[model samples]
Target: MTEILLLNGEPLHTVTPQLLRATSYAHFSSLQVRDGKVDGLDLHFERLDRSTRELFGRSLEAAQIRAVLQAGLAHTDGNASFRLTVLDTDLLLRIEPPIAPSTTPVRLQPIQHQRALPHLKHTGTFDLIYFGRRAQEAGYDDAVFHTAAGEISEASIWNICFARGPEIVFPAAPILNGIRQQVLQRGLAAYETSPVLVSELASFDAAYLTNSIDPALPVAAIGEVTYAPHPESVRTIAAAYASQAAQPI
Candidate 1:
C-alpha cells in the first residue's frame, strides 16, 4: 500500500502505486509486502534464492541478495515493494512492479487435465504461462483451472480455496504453490482438498481465492457455485495470524 521510487540509485519522495487497490495479477514475482508490511521476508528471500537455483540452475548468495536489495533501497523510499523478475532474456533483475491489468473474481469454467509445475514460489502456472487469454474472453473472471485429471489447480493469481461443510479444502496442487499457501499450512485450521470433479461445485459450501496480497475472502459465486462464509475456519486463521504476529520476530 506504499510506494517507494528510486531512479538509478537515487531515491524519490514518492512513487505512484501502479496497482494499489488494483488487481492485475500478471507480474511475475512473489508478494513481499502484506497489508503494508512485508510478510515472511526472510522466508521469501530464502525461497527466492532457492527458486532461482531450482529453476535456473543458479543460486544467489545472501550477499548477492543483500546487495540487490541495498541497491533497490537506495532507489526506493519507504513502504515500497521489492520485485524480483525475469526479463525477456530470462535474466533475473530487480525492477518496479509490472503492468497492472483489470482484475475480477470470475466465475470459472472448470478445465480438465491442466498440470501445474509449482515452482516452490517462483514460476507462475503452466497454463497462465500457456493458455490464459482464452479464459478472459470466455466472459469469466478466470478459469477454475483444473488438472487434466479434473483436480483443481488454481486461479491466475491464487490458490483455489473451497469451503465445504465446515472446513476449507485445499487440494494438493503442488505445481502452483506460492507464499500464501505456506502461511496457510503453518496456521492451524481444518481444511482439506482432495481430487474433485468440476461438477461437484454444487456441493461446495463456499469458495474464495487467496494470494499473498489477500489472505482470505469468501467467494460470492463461481458459475452457480455459492455458499455462506465458513466462519469457524476464518476465525481460526485470523486467530492464528494474530498469535503469529504477537510472537517475537
Candidate 2:
C-alpha cells in the first residue's frame, strides 16, 4: 500500500528539511476508514479538537478538518488507515494501507512508567517506543504500563481491559481514553471503569487490548499471570463494536 501525506489538503511531493526539524509537540488521532466510513468518526474529531485546544490554546475548525480528510480520501480507494495530526495550527493527514483486526493473542511485559500528559494522544512517543522495544527484546509482544503506585494504566499505543465472566472492566487511570475503547464502552451493556492493579490480574478470567487499529485482541499473558484464551469474550466485544453505525467522511 502506498503512503500519502497531505498538509492542509495539499499533497506533498517531497519533504523539506525544515519539515523534518519541526518540534514533536503535536496531538493526533488515527482511525481506520473502510468503505469511506468510520465507526467513531465524531469521537475522533472531538479528540483532535480537544487535544489541539489543550496543547495550542485554540480549537481546530471542524469544517476545515473535514475538508482536508475528504481531500485526502479522494486520492485513495476509500479504504485506508488515516491519521490527522495537529502541529501548532497546521493540519497534517497521513494515509496508509488499512489494517485488519488481529486475532492472535499477545504477551505483555509490565513496565512501571506513565506518560507525561496521558490524556492527549500527542506526538511524544519516545518513552512508549523505548519501553515497547525493551519488552520485545525481553521476549514479550509489547509493554503494558503501570503507574508508580502499581495501578495498570495502559499498554504501548493501546488501552488494556479485563474480562470477568460477562463484565468488561476498563482501567480508570490517567491514560488516553482511546476512541475504540469509548465505542466499546458505549456499545456494551455490562462494563465499568475502575482502578486495575497488577496484583488483581489473577482474579480476572481474560484480558484484551484496544486501539484504533484493532478493537479487541486477546491478551495471552501479562508478566507471569497468564490468561486462558477467551475467544467468546473477544467475539462479544467485537460484535458490540461492529454494531455501531459508521459515519461517512
Candidate 3:
C-alpha cells in the first residue's frame, strides 16, 4: 500500500527537494497504532524528545507531539504504522498499513557495521535497506548488525534479544533502544542486559526479534548458529510484552 504523508498533521502531496533532503537530518519514531491507541506511546514520545534534543538541540513537548500523532491517526483506520519525523520546526508523518507480526521464524545474516549515534532513531534508511537487501539476496530474511569489534548490536529493523534458560538477555551494545524492547524489559521479571558477541550466539538457547510492529519474532538461525524458535523463555517474554497497557495517542 502507498503511504500518506502529512506535514504538521495536514495532507501533503508535493514535497520540495529541500524538505526531502531535510529527512536526512530528521529524527523519527516508527510505531503502531491500534484503534487510536499505541503501546509505549509515552516512551515513543520520550525517544523523539531525547533524539531531537541530541540531534537538533531542540526540546519537544510530549503533549504537542501527541496532538500531531492524533491528527495523523485520524487519517488512518484500525491498526496502522506511523513514521513520525521531526525536521527542525516541522513535523512529518507517514502513515502506512501495518506490518503483520510473523509467528514464523526467520534467519539472520550478520553484517559488520555499526550505526552512527546508536542511541537516536535518526534516518539510516540507506544502510538498513542496503544491508537488508544484501541479507535477503543471501537467502536470509533480515540482517543483524554488529560492530567491527565483534559485538552483536541489533537487527536492521528490530532489537535482538536472547533467551538463556530462565532469563532473557539483551545486547548491551550501543543501539536504538526500541519502544517494544523497553516495554518487554519493564514488564518481564527475568531480564538482563549484557554485551552479546558474535562468538557467543551458540551460548544462548533461543533468540528473538522485537520492534514497534512486532512484539516478538523468533529467530531460527544466525549464520550457522541455530536456535529453538519457540522456547518457553521466549514465550514468557512475549507474554510479558503482550501484557503491557496501551496509552492513548
Best by lDDT: 2
Task: Give me the runs in candidate 3 sitting further than 4 Å from their true place.
Answer: none
**How would you encode candidate 2's per-residue C-alpha lDDT over 53-146 as one tens digit per residue?**
8888998877878998899889889899998888786788899999998878999999999999899898899999999999999999999999
Model 2 accuracy (lDDT, Cα): 0.88
Using TM-score, rank the candidates from best to worst: 2, 3, 1
lDDT of 1 at 23: 18
Per TM-score, the best of the predicted structures is: 2
Candidate 1 ranges with C-alpha deviation above 4 Å: 1-28, 32-37, 86-106, 113-116, 120-132, 246-249
Candidate 1 on 115-223: residue-level lDDT in tens?
4345544344465644456665765656666766666767666677766555667766544666666566566455675765566776876676666656664555655
Location of the lowest summed lDDT over 10 successive residues in candidate 3? 229-238
Q: Candidate 1 local accuracy as lDDT? A: 0.54
Q: Write the per-residue lDDT of candidate 3 for residues 1-249, one digit (tens) a residue.
A: 479998988999999999989998888998888888888988988888888888888899998898888888788775788989999889999999887788888999999988877788888668889999999999999999988888899999899999888688999888988999999988997678988999989999898899987788889999999987555886788578777888877
TM-score for predicted model 1 compared with the true structure: 0.69
**Which regions of candidate 2 deviate over 4 angstroms?**
none
